[model samples]
Target: MFYWFLKWVALGPLLRVVFRPQAEGLENIPTDGPAILASNHLSYADWLFMPLTLPRRVSFVAKAEYFTAPGLKGWFQKTFFSGSGQIPIDRSGANAAEGALISAKGVLGKGELFGIYPEGTRSHDGRLYRGKTGVARLALETGVPVIPVAVVGTDVVAPPGKKFGKVTRPQVRFGKPLDFSRYEGLENDRYILRSVTDEIMYEIMTLSGQEYVDMYATRAKAEAKQAEREAAAEKKAS
Candidate 1:
């Protein structure tokens, strides 16, 4: 399959040579069952580094745009993303979360590892942001244990707005699997979902050791952009 070919034959080897990614707690990942690997989003390289050392195939949901790019460059992009174990799903519209959940559930149903960023988007700053509750819903609905994963130093490998950077080592740490079996039937409860999601984020925070931000990463980015615009307007007026 393309996944194995890309992982073992191409990208995986290249990444090992370039980034020299290191991993700890590999034993925490279930060897032969469905499990959710929930991680903090640091940079685009976060996903790449997480699976570099893992033997089992891991699939992550990517935006639809990555698969729909046109022309030759688009073709390359699509091929690379697909071969890298990314499943494209439209993350827009009212049903975005539902659609993503459905797609992720299918991957898990196949008894494969499903990776998700509970923060929803990459952090503009280095701090960890509040996680969305969708991860909790997925774990509860599928009855899969959530493994808190922390990817460190990837931001240096590929920072935001830059295509690539100098080769640097990044580390991946996997925390123990979290079981929410006691709240099996409470998936529909918003309060319960928030509680479960917060707990997972807490573990990720402890593992990653990044400053905790109560606000979501998307909102923080928007606010930072707004501030930049305001500063530019004031400078132009002066």
Candidate 2:
């Protein structure tokens, strides 16, 4: 109820007026079934714009902090996120990955669309990174079609580490659903998982036209920060 109100009456219309989100390949999404939406993570605004283009609600597993923060501002934050179809999960400690998988399974079990960022984290430089195998594992376990999604220009609307950026029209494109039924029983095989993940990333790359980086986004960010630190140290020594 609140989701519909917030989407149709409150926030969706406002965003449509502001960013003017565009979409392509709308027919790729299943009208009434469970499917995993594997997307490239470019910016925080990806979720907002991607779902705005769909008639169905897309649910994502968000960090528990967004729902548990204290005080009035936190209330608004929680309400807004909840109304936007985000499910809260504690993304801390070793069980974080397992927890997200379970939550996603629950959503899919309900025949709802589950959105996942296969890159694990947002790209620091707008280049599509190698996808983590969790998405492949989930698809294999659930036996659902995996849709490759590319959300472009969201970084312009809301770049990493920032709440807002330049105003530009963001475009969301959906590629055809990928079926990995051939590897149905081999979900436990790491090789199969990697192969499936790579295939999904390739589709996303083709759609978004971003340069492909074989490295994971998290590793790339760490290396970038390390290089910055080394440069600073060398400057100090000089």
- Model 1 TM-score is 0.96
Worst 10 residues of 1 by lDDT: 159-168
Report lDDT per candidate: 0.93, 0.94
Question: Which lDDT tens digits does candidate 1 get at residues 1-238?
Answer: 8888888887788889877899999999988999999999989988888988799989999989999999999999899889888999887888888999999999999999999999999998889999999999999999999999999998998888887866789999999999999999999999999999999999999999999999989999999999999999999999
Error of 1 at 190 (Å): 0.4
Across 93-160, the per-residue lDDT of candidate 2 in tens digits comes to 79999999999999999999999999999999999999999999999999999999999999988988
**Which residue window of length 10 is worst by lDDT in model 2?**
89-98
Error of 1 at 53 (Å): 1.5
Error of 2 at 220 (Å): 0.6
Instruction: Count residue pairs with overlapping backbones in model 1.
Output: 0
